[model samples]
Target: MITIKVPCSSANIGPGFDVVGLSLSIWLTLQVNIVTTTTTTDTTPPPHTLNCNITYEGEGASHVPLAADANLITRTALYVLKCHGQRTFPRTTHVHIVNPIPLGRGLGSSGAAVVAGVLLANSVSKLGLSKDRMMDYCLMIERHPDNVMAAMMGGFVGSYLRELDPADMERKEIPLAEVLPEPAGGINTGLRPPEPPLGIGHYIKFGWAKEVKAVAIIPDFEVSTATAREVLPEVYSKKDMACLSPITGTSGIFNLQRLAVLTTALTRSPPDAELIFQAMQDKVHQPYRKHLIPGLPEILASVTPQSHPGLLGICLSGAGPTILALATHNFEHIAEMIMARFKQEGITCRYELLEPAYEGAQVIES
Candidate 1:
């Protein structure tokens, strides 16, 4: 039996906007039991001929798919196996997944699922791949470094996709549908999937203040990432990119300046509440996403260092119906205030105070 545990993550992190992420304490765990059958008679079935059984519980269990071909975790595992020239599980595999991370609320549920899948493939096939190598497979599926990188590496992290060579660039463009296919029967064994280019992503882990904790103010609704992104403008005006000019900067430079400061600001011993509160402000995604999340603007404006002393900063978590607030103390007060603002908009919410998970993903065999 092999056990894999992957942590949930919060991406964007205010001004970082698809560039930074923090791994949280919540987790998605996968327990695998591969049964090996001894051949006694001619009628004994071969390992590849047996099917995988998947069972899921917690969080999205009510709606999550159980079939190996359809589940994201299983599909991802199959993609890796196919890319490595191993077409199927070597034995009858039983995988049971336990997830506590909320799905589609910008909490990196999908990213965690993808990480678990890659780990599953590595363990089952005895790939002996390094964490970096496993990350290559993960990046191929998620296509973004922010959420997936943090979930895999743990702690606070900043990541970027590498510029591939022309030949590999074409390979990178392969459609996601082809990457993780859902055939009516099972994974397509006829055509080999495009293997991820080696070293497709590079990342650095950042330091996080031990005192600073995350308060997740999650609403009782889902905001798909696609819908949140649809509201953003493709191009920015001079005003949006302007910084330190006579006129005020709006978006681009606004995020850049803050993001530069925030990466280090969070590592200081005595965190600066006021500085962090300002640093966490965004001009990239959150402002545009306000319309999708009711009371978003109000909560960001009303909750502050002056109003809530222990509060350091607050921002929309990922694409968000969940608001993440960084604070030192007075967690309940901060949560209540944010929840009250959401309540005014006729939205109900719950809160969780989480610490960063220092260790990324873990695997155990017995």
Candidate 2:
């Protein structure tokens, strides 16, 4: 028997779309116990005749459909078992899940499952696979690296996949030099992503900060991840992508500035709410996702220093509905203001005050 506790995650932190995330305090606990049993009196249970019993607790457990196709946990578990070269399923296997995070509310419900499934499989099989290997498989399964990192490694995280020189792997600070590798065949192949014969494939970087905390305003209604994704435009101008300087000047949400502010905000013990508020101001996905959340515009407008002094910054957690407020103080006040805004528009909502979970995902026993 093995028990795995994986923290839920919040991703796309404002400006850093698909690149930033944080693990919340809430967790989805999975308990898997493998036992021996046979249905037939002759003791002839077929291959994969595992008595699989799955149970769920907490938010969305009642109504949410648990289709075998959509259950990342079960899928990844089967994959992990396959990876371990385990051909036969346990005769009697009981799997239990307890979730506090809301599904389809942009609170990283799937991310938790991904982490949980991989961890559960690895533990049950006694694979002793490295964390990196687990992460690679998880990314392939979930398609969300930022959320994966937060759930796997915990705390506030900024993650991205990029090609780089092996020599630059240990770069501690800024002033990076890009040195193109010379081809072994002598012919120049021009600049390209590092993969295959060219070099090692793209590697994902996970930067973690354990100090930052957040307040999530989770609404009663849900937003489908696919629906929210479909509404976003397929492309954007480079200037719009980077938020070009000069014209917008100081007020503009420059990528470099946003990145710097976010990293600093997370690293600092007592996060600067005003700085983070400005830092998290994004021109990315939120504008397009507002309509999905009722009274979103009003909620955004409701947070002010005078009204919600504890609120550091607020943005859509991932794709929709649930809004996260990053802060170091006055969590209740910030949550109150957000709930008030939601109530003003007759929207029912609840809020949770959460600190960053630095441990990520771990097994309770060996």
Candidate 3:
């Protein structure tokens, strides 16, 4: 039996939309057992018969699928195996999942599931793929590097997808249907799925101050990432851009400047609450997403280092209904202020105080 553990993640980090992420303490764990039951003393390779069972508990237990073809983890594992020329799972396989991360709450639930799947395949097949190579498989499924990379590598992380050559770009454009196809009539052995472009993602881990911890003020609701993205405008006017920019600059330049500063600012020993407060301000996505999340503007505008002591910075966690506030002390006080604002908006919320999961994903066998 093998046990795989993966951490949940929060992406965007205020100004760095889709560019930065931080792994939190919550986890998604998978316990897998693969047994061989062969009565015949056959020397040749056994037929690829599918016998897989999955059981899930925690967060989305009522709604999450258990079938191998429908579950994200198993489907992703099968996708990786298919790429390496293997068709089916071992004759007898069982996977038990315990998930704590909330789904559709911008907390990288899907990303963790995908990472767990890749690790599962690597262990069961005895594939000696390096972490970097396993990341390639993850990118193919999740398509976003911020959440997945942070979940896989841990700590405070920044990542980007590399520019592919013309041929590889074409390969990159392969539709999701083709990449993770449903095995309608058992596993398809016809045309092979396109493999991911080599080194398609590159990332670096950033330093985080030991004093800083996160307070996740999560509302009792779900905000789909797709819905949050659709509300954003295709272009920004100069006035709209100027709201976030210190100078008369475009929105892109505004976020870039803060992102660069925020990355290093977080590494400082004591941490400058004032500097981090200004750096965490965003113009890219938050402004448009306020409608999706009630009391968002009030929370960001009212909660400040000056108004509340011990508060470093705060922003929407992912495509959130969950707000993340970074702080050093007075964690409960910080959470109360945000929760009060949310209550005024007729929304009930719960908060979690979490530290960064520095170790990231791990696999253990017994």
Off by over 4 Å in 2: 36-43, 46-49, 64-70, 162-212, 242-253
What lDDT score goes with residue 103 in model 3?
Answer: 89
What's the distance in Å from true for residue 114, model 2?
1.2
- Name the lDDT value of residue 249 in candidate 3: 48
Give the best candidate by TM-score: 1
| Candidate 2 weakest ten by summed lDDT | 172-181
Segments of candidate 3 deviating more than 4 angstroms: 38-49, 189-191, 241-252
Tens digit of per-residue lDDT, candidate 2, span 1-366: 778898888888888888878888898998777765555553764333233556777887877434322355765565556545553335566678888888888989888888888887787667886676777657555655788888988777777654546654543121211112222221121122121112211333344344456889888888988899888889966655665456645444465578677776666656666777778877667888888888887777678555676667788889868888876678887887788888877888899888778778989863
lDDT of each: 0.88, 0.69, 0.88
Worst 10 residues of 1 by lDDT: 41-50
Please give, for residues 1-366, the per-residue lDDT of candidate 1 as tens digits.
Answer: 999999999999899998999999998999999877744454655433225788889998899988777788988888888888887776678999999999889899999999999999999999888999999999888988999999999999999998899989888777887788655555454257878889999999999888999999989999998898899889977666545645543344788889999999999979999899999988888889999999899899999999999999999999998999999999999999999889999999999999998898889999
lDDT of 3 at 328: 96
- Candidate 2: deviation at residue 159, Å? 1.4
